[model samples]
Target: MHDDEEMLRRLRVDDLPPSMVDLNRAMRAGRRRERMGAVVAGGLAAVLALGTVVVVAATTGKNTAAPWPGAGPEGSRSPEPAPPLGNCTIDEAPVASQSRMIKIVANRSGQVFVMQDPLKSGNLLRWMDGRQERIDGVPTGDGYGTAAAVNGSGAFVGASGYKPAWVYRDGTFTVLPLPPDVSAMSMVGINERGDLIGTAFYWDGRDDTRAVLWPASQQGTPVLLATPAGWSSEAMDIADDGTVVGYLSHRTDNGPVDITPMAWGLDGSARRLPVPAGWTPARAGKRGPYPIAIAGDWVVGAGARWNLRTGTAEVVEGLMPMKVDKYGRLFGNVPLSVPDNGSTSGRPAVWVNGDVQPLPIYPDRPEGTLFSVSLDGRRITGTSYVTSGAFGTATWTCGR
Candidate 1:
C-alpha cells in the first residue's frame, strides 16, 4: 500500500472501539449514521415503503395552448415550463441544545428519526409534515439509553438500562428476552420482517458474545449465530431479505484486538466474507467498507460494493459511504475538509453512477455531516455544526 493509504488505514482502524458506549459518543466525529445503537444497513427504506413526494401535473379541463394577446400562432405553447427548481435547506431549529450531541439520524419512508442527547437524553424525536413529535415517555435508563434501529412501521429498537435491549412498538416498550447465561444484550438492526439482529454479551468478565436474531412476531425461537472459537461477534445491520452483517473481534496471544467481517443467512447459517484486497481490518469495520447495505445483487460498504454472484468488487474512488439509499447509491462526506472553529470540516458528497457530486450546503449552516438519506434519496438528515461550536439535528430536501 502507498504510505498515505497505509497511514489513513491505520488512523481509521485506531478510531474503532469495541465498546458501544465509546462508539456511540465518537459518532459525533463523523461516524456511521445508523440508528441509535446499531450499525447502518439502510434496510428501513425497503421495508417501510417510503415513497418520495412527486410533483403531479397541474391539469385543467380546458386546453391552454392557445396563444395569448401578443402571441404568434393559435397552437403555440410557451416552451414547456422548465422543471421545478427543487427546494433544499436545513431545518430552522437545532434538534437539541449545544450541550448535547445528536448521534443517530434515521428515516423510514418519509418520516425522520433523530436521537437527541444520545445515551444521555434518551429522547426520540420524529419529524413529519414539517412538524416534530417526541414519542412520549421512553425509558432513558439512567440517561445512558441509545436508539439502535427503527423499522418501516415506525417501530424502534435499542438498548436501555440493565437489560441492554428493548423495543418500542405501538407506543409500548418490550424488553427483549436474553439467553440463559447472557446478562447484557445490544440490539442493533431490525429488518422489515420485524426480525431483530444484535449481540448478546455475558457478565462473566469474558469478552465473548454471539450474534442473535429475534423474530418480529415474537413467535419462533430466537436464533443464536455461531462464531468461531475465541472470537466475539456483534450483529450490526440487517437487510430486508434477512441477510445479517457484522464484525468478529478476537484477541491475539500477546494482546491486541483483531477484527474480521461476518455475514449470516436467515436460517442462522454463518460465513465470513473476504475483506476487499489490500483493505486492512480497521479500514473495514464498525463504520464500514464492510457490507452494511445488502440488496438482490449488491453488498455495499463505505466506498465499495461487491457483486454477490460474480464476487467482483467495485470501489468508488474518493467517497466514504455512511448510508445507502434503496437504489444502492452511497451517501457520505468527501475527504475534502474546510476550516471551522480551528478544526477541519468535511463536505457532504454522494456517488451516482460512480461520479461524485457534493450536496448543496445551506448558507446559514456552513458545515454539516450527511448521515441518513430518504429511501428515495430526496431527503437527508444529520447534524450541522455552526462556526460557534453549536450543533443541532438538521434535514435537507430536494424536489419537495
Candidate 2:
C-alpha cells in the first residue's frame, strides 16, 4: 500500500463513522439514456434463480422461465417476485435468502444452492448443494443465524448464528474456525477458489475492527488487514484477485463517523474511493464498491454520492452512481429518495451511457428498483414486494 493511497483512504473517511447514500437522481439520469442490449447468437448468458435468507419461495417452478410477478408495461415480461411488504432498504430486503440464492459462480458447472434455515431456539446452520440434492451437508453452531453469502459455486456464508465462518462445497459445510485471537466474525465474500474474506473483531475486545481472510487451504489464522487503528470496517464484496470493498472510519470533531465506499486489496493496501461529483455542497465521503459485480481494474456496485465530476452531490440532482458492467456499461436507477416517498413509488427508470436511456421494466410495475447485480452484470435484480403504489422488487437484464 502506497503512503499516498493510505493517506487518501484516511482523508476520505475523516468524517462519519458509519455509512453512505445519494442515488435517486442518478437513476433518473440513467433512465433517459437506456437502450436495448444486443442479442447475441446464443452466447450462453444463463440466469439461474433462487433466494437467499428471509424470503418466501416463489411457488412458480420452471427451469428456463420468466417471472409471473404480474403487471408491467403494455408489452413486456412479468417482473420478479415482490418482497414482503415493508420499508427495508434494498440491502435489507432480498432477491434470495440464506436458504437459497442464485450466485453467478465462477468455478463450477451448473447451478448451486447455499441454503440456511432454523432449528430449535436461535441455533442456525448452512446446507450446501451442487447439481444434486442428495449431496447435502450442513454446518451447525451457536448464536442466531442467517447466511449472507456470494453464490455461484465457490460461496461463503457466516451467521450471527455462529462464531466463525463456514464454506459450502459440493454438499458440504466446511466449518473453518477462526484463530484464538479472533472473536465475532462475518463472512462477507468468497473468491473463485473459495478464499473467504470479511470483517473481524479480536478477542482483546475493543471497539476496533479489521478485515480478515481465510483461505480454502486451511492453515493459518485469519490475518488482520492493515488499516488505521481507531476505525471499524464492514466488508461488502471481494474479487477473484482478492480486492475488498468496505469502509474506513474515524471520529470527526462532531462525533464518530465513517469514510464510506472504501476499497482494500489482499496485500493489506487500502485506498478510499472518491465521492461522485453530484453530492450536495461537496461533502467529502463516498459510499461503496457494492461487491464489484464485475471484476478487473474497475470496481462496480450500487451506491450514491454527489457526482463531484458533475458537481451535483449537494444540489439534489436526482440520479445515482450505478455499477459498472464487465462491458464497461453502467446501470443505475434512481435511489430511495424519490417523490413517492422514495421507498415505494415505482420511479420508472432506465440505464444511461452518455445520451442513451435503455428502459428496464414497464412504466408501471409494483415497485421498481435496481438492486443486487449479477456476477456477469448483464442484469440487475432488485425487489418489487406487492401492489401498493410502487411497492415490489423487480430485476431486469439490461437490454436495448
- Best model number under lDDT: 1
Write down the lDDT that model 1 would get: 0.53
Candidate 2 runs further than 4 Å off: 1-137, 142-145, 160-162, 179-183, 201-205, 216-220, 256-260, 276-294, 300-323, 335-350, 354-365, 368-372, 387-395, 398-400
lDDT of 2 by residue, 1-400 (tens): 5422233343333432234434343442232122011111101111111111111111122111211112133332222221221111222222232221222122211133333332233332322342312223344454443444545653545544436456655545666667556656656667666667767655465655666777556525566655665666656566666766665544445542434556666655555554433332222122232333334334444333212011111111233333443333344444323334323233323333332243344444433434345444444544443243333334454332
Q: Model 1 reaches what TM-score against the true structure?
A: 0.66
Best-performing candidate as measured by TM-score: 1
What lDDT tens digits, residue by residue, belong to model 1 across residues 2-114? 32123123113333334211122244213222333333222111111112211111121211111211213333121222233245555633344344344464644435454
What lDDT does the true structure give each of the candidates? 0.53, 0.40
User: For model 1, where is the 10-residue window of minimal lDDT?
Assistant: 42-51
Per-candidate TM equals 0.66, 0.56
